[model samples]
Target: MSQKKPSKCKKKQTDEISLSKKRNTRAGNMGIGYETAADFAKRGANVIIACRNKDRAEAACEKIKKETHNQDIHYKLVDLSSFASVRKLAEEINQTEDHLDILVNNAGVYNVGNQLTEDGQQLLIQTNHYSPFLLTNLLLDLMKKSKSRIVNVSSLAGMAAKMDLEKLNKYNNFFTDYALSKLCNIMFTIELASRLKGTSVTTYSVHPGTVKTEIIRDSGLVAIVSRSIIRTLFKNATEGAQTSIYCAVENDLEPFSGEHFEDCHMVERYKSAQDVWIAKSVWAKSENVVQLR
Candidate 1:
């Protein structure tokens, strides 16, 4: 279950007055996204939680705000599966926020079936990768207003995946599509960083371990067993959020832009993740599909 609005965080730390400004941020409000927002909120960042469910997102926002004592936390309805919804949220943020300091593409899905979105994109790929792909591009202008950081939440499932648009549609199975989506996130980070170089913006991808979240709650027996195992064998959202928080705020990491991080440190990734050609291809295809300018 998504954490109940946490009790006022007994562990919440305070910052100097100078550090207490309303920083613009937008992230998913589930799993590591919740902890990630709490971390930012504890530090006085203005956080916007985006998700498909407005009521849940709002409840999450309230809980986070109370716990972190950061009333600036709010929720916006966003359906990642729909390009229109993603674009609308991006446009709203860009117009309303003078500067976006942190953008965490941390929301994802893990369903056990194959289906297409109303937009006709594969479900998992659209939700996990393409939605963020399009959302990030639309928000780039506002992010540029600050020395900003964008964190794309990825996973180990992507280890060996490559972007072959011709074969992309053929990957209709559950695990394969999810894996490819994660890989696409990594490549998006790589290519987006290259594109944003010297522009005071940086992007990074994070492999939050098999977190015990509702991500797999609906995928049937395997997911139930996997969730149980994840609870036993892997990190919770708080622990999983660590690396994402590190990448978004660690001052020293400015040097490692575009890198993949795990356990709060940068590490070597699947060599296939370094395929610039694949990254470019993914970027081009994403642009075309999203019809970016």
Candidate 2:
């Protein structure tokens, strides 16, 4: 693929929120991911919603098709905790789609416990960071076929995370693991942008603010007991999806490719996210973890 001139994304532009039949936008998860996909579908994009559950994916597709009055939405199954599953999803997309215009790595977990995936990695890390990293790498060729934007849904929790390259695959407490995974998402975006510099792909990390979603359903009693308060304080799925949707469809974002965004605007990246050395080191470690050749 030939490289396209990087847009002078110095000044952020308003949201376009439209996609043609030639552009394909894929988002993961069900909550904000669903909202993001629906918004794209409303604008006439070919949308694919990827997730682990067959029932949920099917239902989400059906609902989105009805709500958007756009029948182009579809679903595919993907277990983010498994490398095999991630690869399979990527393979299927690459084989079936002519080109990919946007990829939203929106699915993630929190406080999922100390268990490991079949891939022998911490469940949280695998689901939140490693699998997305591998999937992006696997789909790069297809994405490069068109001008593409890669959005990894990160979190504000990443601001509190301290980078420890060795602890990436090791599980500590739930909170610690979750923070680390989010930090890794930012690092992954930074490194991926550097690697894809002259290419047609631009990547970003986004914080969808605190949203009312099942992401916290595994946080045990505190989450259960605080559900009402959480709902009262957090943004709804559509509101929370603004930044991810912004990064995906907004124009002139190529110059800020590796930057972090929140509230639909580019904000200062966390101190840790600015560490290029650490970002490179994290990428190397992640490649080994995912066995990316």
Candidate 3:
């Protein structure tokens, strides 16, 4: 979540912030996402946080309402591992909500094993890249109704990723798969912004810094040591959430759409992420995977 700063843009009383979450998301609870949602609520924006867990979602909503004094805060159910769940949530939102002003594809997994979701896609890739791609596309129509910003929470790990489209679903190693997923997030933002050109919608990919959160699910001695080191040295949830919140509310960001952001400011895109051809190919592959014909 963001700092409790009021939005610089003109506000409609009905302006809504719709963000995606999941049960195993590292950013859930008092993580970066919760802070991002809380900041928005403090601004009096109608916020809908979609998560897979019912109990946690309700508890989060109630806590945000109490803390921000914004009764407009609500939650919806969604499991990023399943396209059906994503589609269901999207359909519900499109039917019930008038417009979506901001969308943060914030939830992701780290080093989950080489498993596959029910949709038959690789579990890590589906949760980190494919589901969010599908969710963002599904919500584009409603977002188009108003000036909107879509924030894909990418990672610095993306910079190290070497794109291999054929192996996107075939995991090589824990770090490689996670890096590829993050790289896809940036590429998706680029392709999405190109497609949304001339419209009122803009998109950004953000590296929320090395945050200490539950998304780190690696194992073994090295993994444990790395987690401990990360917890000791990296930014906390509040610091990690700043860029996401900035992307959501920054008024002058339209001109920088499709760019990468860090430290709450626009930054250079990774060399691989800037490749238009690869980005387009990733988009095509994602469309086929999500069956968004």
Candidate 4:
């Protein structure tokens, strides 16, 4: 006699329940940020989904909640382009959580035409570099308290950057602004790691393999021409998030503070990025910027 097959309804319910635990296990460009949060939540982490849009953040939280069956997932509004918003969010996090386990400096902007922040810094530089620097500093005490890990998502584009104190604003070149911002990320990660040595906190910077995302859409002509090629050539967002997730959760990484990573392995940074003088100068400049607040 043939055995009875499981009911389709039962199969569907099981699938949904499994997904509710860990959704989107595969690589995809758009949902990786949420996927990373979901994975962390499944591992019993309480995550804060920081984003510029309240609606989008809430929607992302809901999706993670439904997918992971984890109510600890929540959202916070933060516009990295604005220092005030970053401070506000940091204050709120400090007040609410006794500890922050992981701080991922993942949100970034690029290819946007010349734009400036209220502080008069270039928008990409402000968002990608300065604001994260400021926010991390403000939250350092809490991170130290929790012995949290800090991960900065830098870029391969940073290799092309040349530290130009005079042209940091890149008044004539938007691409330089973007590249320099990423370089700043790496430098900040290294310096912070050095400062936090012997402490529970550690810092790392990663070059997330090129992934097709909305960042390119900001560049009209180039985006139109490159979209298809990028889609075909680049890893999806989940793949991009891999090193970030690895850095956030892996035990082996804690001892290797200040290291730069790509595809889950340590790699040397650009010569300029590794310059002690450049790092010191950038750190001083960053301190001044945050002190103004």
Q: Against the true structure, whose TM-score is highest?
A: 2
- Residue pairs with colliding backbones in model 1 are none
Model 3 bad stretches (over 4 Å): 1-30, 217-219
lDDT value, residue 163 of candidate 2: 95
Ranking the candidates on TM-score from highest down gives 2, 1, 3, 4
Q: What overall lDDT goes with each candidate model?
A: 0.80, 0.85, 0.83, 0.74
How big is the positional error of residue 244 in model 1, measured in Å on the Cα after superposition?
0.5
Scored by Cα lDDT, where does model 3 land?
A: 0.83
lDDT of 2 by residue, 73-188 (tens): 88888998889999999999989998999999999888777888999999889999999999999999999988999999999999989999878778788888899999999999
Winning model by lDDT: 2
Q: What's the TM-score of every candidate structure? A: 0.91, 0.92, 0.89, 0.87
Residues 1-293, candidate 1: write the lDDT tens digits. 23232112111121221332457777767788888888888888888888888778888898997898878898888998899998898888878888988899999887746677888887778888888999999888888887889999999988956666765555567777778889989999999989998897899999977788888877578877897888789888888888787777765466677888887777776676978888999999888878887
Looking at candidate 3, the ten consecutive residues that score lowest on lDDT are: 18-27
Report the candidate with higher TM-score, 1 versus 2.
2
Candidate 4 per-residue C-alpha lDDT over 1-293 given as tens digits, one digit per residue, 9 for 90 to 100: 13232121211111122221221111111355765676676665677888887777777778777877878777778888788898998899889877776888887887777887888887878888888898888888887775578889899988998887777665656678788888999989888988898888898998878887677765477678778888889877667677777767665467678878887767767776979778878888988876744
Task: Give one clash count per candidate, in the order shown.
Answer: 0, 0, 4, 3
Task: List, residue by residue over 169-218, the lDDT tens digit for candidate 3.
Answer: 99788889999999999999999999999999999999989988778755
List clashing residue pairs in candidate 2. Answer: none
Error of 3 at 284 (Å): 0.3
Model 3 lDDT, residue 127, Cα: 92
Clash count for candidate 2 is 0
